[model samples]
Target: MADLGVKTPDVMTRVSEFMPEIITYIQTIIDNGFAYESNGSVYFAVSEFHEHPKHCYCKLVPSGMSNAELLAEGEGVLSGAADFVSEKRKPNDFALWKKSKEGEPSWNSPWGEGRPGWHIECSVMASDVFRRLGDPEGGMDIHSGGVDLKFPHHDNEMAQAEAESGSGQWVNYFGFKMSKSLKNFITIQGALEQNSARQIRLCFLLHKYNEPMDYGDSTMTHAITTESTFNTFFQNVKAVLRDAHQDDSAKWEGAETELGNAIDATKGRCHAALCDDFDTPAVMAELQKLIGSVNKYLETKAAKQEKPVVFVVKHAATYMTEIFKAFGLIGNGPEIGFPLGGAEGGAGKEETLTPVLDAVLEFRSAIREAARSKNFGDILSLCDKFRDDDLPELGVQLEDKAGSKGVWKLADPAELKRLKEQEAAEKARKAAEKAAAAAEKARKEAEAGIPPIDFMKALKLDDGNTPKYTAFGDDGIPTHGNVGEAPGEELNKNQKKKAAKEFAGQQKKYDKFVAKK
Candidate 1:
């Protein structure tokens, strides 16, 4: 719960803490003739309870269920416990207290050593929690659990609580059911791993609480996407607020009317939906519509210079926060300028982009801001080219949002390093090949019966330009640069081309000579 940012419930009552109360309630039911003792055990007389006008068995069961079907359905005992149906005078009668067998835990009772039954425990725990809160009336405003428990479990709980307290409508039950077998259930740890608590809450709010929801890929993905949209919308509004001139009440023409109408409509729908049985999905739809209208209003050109529009946006954002709070979707975290939580950490201490990537992005932003209009055009072109070419080589991606501001993030550092190494190796191999070619040219020229005009010119030869043999050495030594091997930098492009041509031409004779040898 701490990891997921879920707060602990205030009144967490344990079943064991209310064991004595459970026993007392069972005795109360027995004394009122609603329950009976059988074979040292006590069972709720469903038929007898049904006989009374107000004390009848709760019909939490399915509609159209026959008496026989109700009896069969109610026969489901607590997990790992056997039903004492043979001891009951009626098949629909449910156990209130069970006699402890040998080696089983038991408590001393009027009848014998026994333990309180399963359904009885919940009633005692709920009532005890209510009483501790200074409510002498043990009735709860709402009781909720899976619809699967509505039949025997919740029904039995309601009966015991109402029968003991002599109170009608002990709980306004919200029978919300989810099933792991049907893929609608996710544990807290599992849910928190993929999404924030706010996102999860918003997901539930997007659907009616009473209806079953399938917690699958599309459902969660929609939630995440919607959350991202809301975060971005709020961030954009904040940006507008920060840059707006406080004194400038300049309106964006019709932006005020449009946005004001949206706000009014949103508030109306939200109020109506919530008032009608807490229709959270309708409220969320209204919130989503409000966000869209706000974003469109922000996109107007006049909005940039208008303080009134900014104020309107800011006010709407505040109201959106209120809606978030109402849905318990207001996330807990330190605010760093803008709303941080969404698809990312949102201040949950989750891992964010590395510092190196952040620094690179900051540098890019600095250069982008420094560039003038023409320079910025060039820069933008350069950025696009680099994004398509060099940036990918480094395994980085650049995302350009509105207003020319962009974000850069690393995709894979290891892949980038590997690509760099591969490029370096390719460059080195090309250099070595060029050098070898130059060496072969030098050798072929030295043996080609051509004369170097001077040692100075030969030594000072410009790469790939035909060495002009301009100056001579003493003893007429025709200053050849290298007899066999030479560096590629010493050979110009033309010289290398000529040398390669000569080498190709002489290759047949060289092969013959080798064969002869």
Candidate 2:
């Protein structure tokens, strides 16, 4: 949770720690005539709760009140016990407490040695915590759980809480769900292993919290592309800022005005999107548009050999950073935009390495300048070695620009190394393929140079040693020979025709070979 940037809750209570409270809440429900004591167990009286004037049973999902399969599932593993069905007055009635079997954990209760049921513990714990915090009414504005829990779990929590407090509605809203049976479940650690926390969080933010999210290839690809887009924009902005100088003589221009207007419009749209149930996809679109505007502004200035208005660009970047921080995409720090390294230890590590990297880059730049001045090819190659080889091992990527200006960035060393190896492998593969093709072409040329007489001599018989044919036609094709015991055996009509067709195909090359000779 810390790595993912999720905030810690104010109160964290265990169900076992509140066992007495759970038992008390069940007793209160029984006294209020909304629950009943069955043989050595307790069950919520669904029909009674529904008939009560102030309380409504299964209000969240009224249709699930009569869903036997979902009700049994909500009741849990013991729902199929021999006495489980007989203990309840109605099929829809759910257990508040269950009698313990042999070797099961038990607690001393008025009904018997039994344990609190699954749904009642949550209601009791939440209500008890609220009561201790001076919210004596013990009702909350929101109740959150999986969608699968809407049927009996959440509805039962509502029934139990309202029955105890005499409150009409215990919760105003319910939130989120994920499934394990569908095989879509992933542990936090497992997900973090495959992608950064930002990518995972972005995947969630891209969709509404209540909506079902598909966490597959397309979704993850979007997340990666979205994060890369923002990161690249930030890097480009930083590069512009680095080269920019204070221009006291510069005045406001149309580009500046246009960018400023875009920034203001984006601010409004982003705010409205966030206010509209945190419509993050809309907010992301607006942010992307703002980035596009800023990029255009930078490009226009660069094309004209003019520097951008520093204050205007800074204002836009600052606002963007603020919004990103609010979304928890950027961290609470001085650095703007998402950290290129990652969420864990990225900022601190970059801070430590920045000075050293700058020094190394400066040295490499001096060497490159000297190499250019002296026309020293080896020195230039050495400079390239540092840029292409050494720095990448330390997670730094150096890109050379047109005027020998190089920009550097922090990247994943392992990924950089893999890419380098892949590039080298591809180069080697192409080289090998080229060499094989050249050899094949040379072998064909050598064969083409052979005269018709030598060509016929190269054809061996089935016995492997003797020549197959003793003579050749004019176009370097076999005419007659080992078809009989002597050299003068004439080919039959079929053989003659086949030889004529084969020789016709090679005649052009044969004539060229003879002319060259």
Candidate 3:
């Protein structure tokens, strides 16, 4: 406090000077046997005065409690004029007040709540100062500072202040360790002005709130890696958007809703994963699959699938945008970059190739027809037309095998097919005649043991391997179309006739046994 030339941790010195009510209470503690007056000084008899054992708060000390902070058996023998001071109490019993020499701040009391010893300051200042602030009952809400204030600082304050006030009314003391030696540190003003807030926030985010984390460069790398991974999903979406048909004189459109619906489903899954423990890796998995789908759509949308390009891209943009926003990324919309025609399409590709191919096929059909008519000259002429015109691109070569016995040699499938039918018919006819002859012989033999004359003859042939034959001329015509009688030089016609007659009578008598019939 400047008013008294006694300084504490900046504000504390001034507050102690202004708030003299706390000074009064420190004086009262001195009056009790728990604390004492010593040449105008006062100290707590920690063990003589409390329910706590010496080791109670020792565990809170990092390097372990020091005997220096403990009230030694012989230390406080110097403090005088108190009723129950003892030598055996711990050295860390601590002072409630100490006598001020000339020119130091002093006040009268039962003992006097004067200058607060290191521990006395917290209890006295908090209790009466808080009561002056109108929360006599609610001493303070929370006292958060550093972990280094264990043992002597915290434990001694608790023993004396709570003992004096007797209300046990104040909030529990919570110490957060602060040590320059340990490097568990930050300065608030330095953090706010950073150019890279994202890196900073992300670095802070990686640690669970209640756990300790050392500040380092690796944290920045994690933040950047996360950004890069998230950016990849947007890249894939852009690729998919590119698949939307080019804006031509005639624009093609697609179902934006469907593409959007699909993209949204993917994003939803990603967001859900992120919400669960901020699982960025799982979100990335969803992005990977979504981007893959986007690539597939871009590659296939026009050529292989029927969807309209614009429609697909519109929805892809919608879902991808929403998901990208969640990850703080963005997309550049589709542009007309696709080439006008596809791989096999030539210049005026669909146009030129369609009619060209049709005409080629027509000409081929005409040439084949001419071959069918056995018009070899016409076939050769037409083949020449095809060879000279469309042959190069068509990629076919023709060779003539005009008289070969192969399926292609036959010009007309109909006639080649007709000749096959004729051969099949002839075989069927012969087979039917043989079957009829066998039936006729069987019927005649069944009617009588001596078969009918014609039947007997047929039966003989049926039983025999070969049958004899006789000629039955259609008319009384000579075999070679010569119909004159044979001429003789010496005999008259009547003389010849008489001789011929005698020979005929002899032939007739032999005819019954002869095979002439």
TM-score of each: 0.64, 0.72, 0.34
Ranking by TM-score: 2, 1, 3
**How should the candidates be ordered by lDDT, best one leading?**
2, 1, 3
Model 1 clash tally?
A: 8
Clashes per candidate, residues 3 or more apart or on different chains: 8, 0, 15
lDDT minimum window of 10 residues, candidate 3: 475-484
Of 2 and 3, the candidate ahead on TM-score is 2
Give the top-scoring candidate (TM-score). Answer: 2
* Deviating ranges (above 4 Å) for candidate 2: 132-136, 181-183, 248-250, 340-389, 403-406, 410-517
Candidate 2 per-residue C-alpha lDDT over 62-102 given as tens digits, one digit per residue, 9 for 90 to 100: 89877888887877655454577888888888899999888
Candidate 1 lDDT, 1-517, residue by residue in tens: 6664467888777766677788887888888778899888888887777677776565576341245554455554431224476788876677788888888888888779888777888888888888887767588876778766676778788888777777767786564756657445668888776666666776787888878777876777678667767766665665666667867665656878878888988898889999898898888788888888877776665457434556677768888887776566665432311233335435433334454465558557756775844466567566666665556544565667688676554434443444345457669988999999999988865544333222224443445565533323363433333322553234445654544454444554455545655
How far off is residue 81 in model 3, in Å?
20
User: Which is better, 1 or 3, measured by lDDT?
Assistant: 1
